[model samples]
Target: MEKTASVSGAQTIHKAISLLKFIARFSGEGARLIDLVRGMEIGQPTAHRLLQALVAEGLVKQDTSHRYHLGSLVFELSLTSGHHFNLADICTPVLKKLADETGDTSFLFLRSGDDAICLAREQGPYHIQTPVVPVGSRQPLGVSAGGLAILSALSEQEAAAVLKAITPRLVMFGNLTTDRVWEYYLKSNAVGYAAISNRAAPGVKGVGVPIIGEIGTPIAAVTLATTISRMTEERIQEIIPALNEAAEQIDVLLRQF
Candidate 1:
């Protein structure tokens, strides 16, 4: 009886996790029950029960329109400071300094659900800068150096889930596959940062470091973007320290609030 109960509980947890991921996929507009139930193997009754349990745990919330959204507790667990964070504003000074020091355009990217959003950019003195990703653009969380850095900072399981969620969007990048992104994540994890080239734009190169927020969760990334000419293997090695320092500085500043 005990073993049977344990297996059943594990299945329940798995279903709940699936439900959360589903809601996150459609999080922008929120998710309705029928929307969630459609095409999923889990029946409506089971999903509703799981959602209620998640809601009771503050992991999910329902609105007047009966739409489900990830709850404040989710942010609290990741950010710990409620909903008032201005990650770009907080990281601008570091971005400017990084750009000035490296002569490569610096970008601040915030993790938004399964996507990475470019919140701000600081152009360097380099006349041939490559700001391929403009501010306010969004991409899957394992696409560029910025997103890969954020993915590298997450726990193995969390990173895998994110990779699974973003696999469909990865195809738009020509050569990006879930396996390729996972390889990038593994490399970044081993090397303490992320670097990518010629993917976001031809001849573009970038190095990124993840910013550790409250509770040690990676909430953003600081990426130094440049042309391949300026970001050679030697320069990438040289620029990593500056990027790490800037990420640390941003992390420290973010904790103050």
Candidate 2:
């Protein structure tokens, strides 16, 4: 029999997160009940119970076909928590300025479970804007500079949980292991910024900074990307100050509502 990993003293939460992740993998079309149960290695009754709870909470929804998909609440929550909406709108101006001034592509990314999804993008004036990570695309945290910045800004326990959750997904990116992500986090934290190579695009590099919440937790990240030939070490250092400024401005704007 295959050994299944369980979180000590938090089995229910673990199972729930696992279920959600499993559903997300197939939720593009819709996830079937038997598939979810088998994929999560949980019994039918337990899966049903969890699914019901998630539906009630508006995190997941069951359609007329008896298949599940992520709910609208997820998108709403991404914008605000008990406040106004327009997260993308709030940050777009800052990103636009960054792109125009730096002559590189700028992106805004938000964390959703163990993955980072690009929320917005601003193309630079440069003729060759690096098509690193496209808007709406999601990838495991630490795969891109913006994601790495968010991961690095997380508290130790939070960061550990995210890393543990995304471990299996990292293999798709060549040589991007858990240890490698941890190393990236350390480096980003030390420099007060994230400068990562191959930001989901080979031969590309990106620099980013986290937008810290009032409690000092990272809520999102802003990044600028270009080809390796354009993102030299000195350039990375030079861009850090501007990136940090933009992140700070966005954080302040977020607190208004």
Top-scoring candidate (TM-score): 1
What Cα-based lDDT does every candidate model obtain? Answer: 0.81, 0.80
Cα lDDT of model 1 by residue, 1-257, tens digit: 99999999998888888888888787446789998889466789988898899987767867667888876357545653543346567778888999998888998887777777787899888787888897888889878789889889887877898898888878788668888888899999999899887767678878999986543557788899888787888988899899889888876776674
lDDT score, candidate 2, position 32: 95
Off by over 4 Å in 2: 1-85
Write the residue-wise lDDT of candidate 2 on 172-232 in tens digits.
Answer: 8876889989989888888788888864888988889987654344667899999999899
Clashing pairs in 2: none
Task: Tell me the lDDT of candidate 1.
Answer: 0.81
Clash pairs detected, candidate 1: none
For all candidates, what are the clash counts?
0, 0
Candidate 1 off by > 4 Å: 1-87
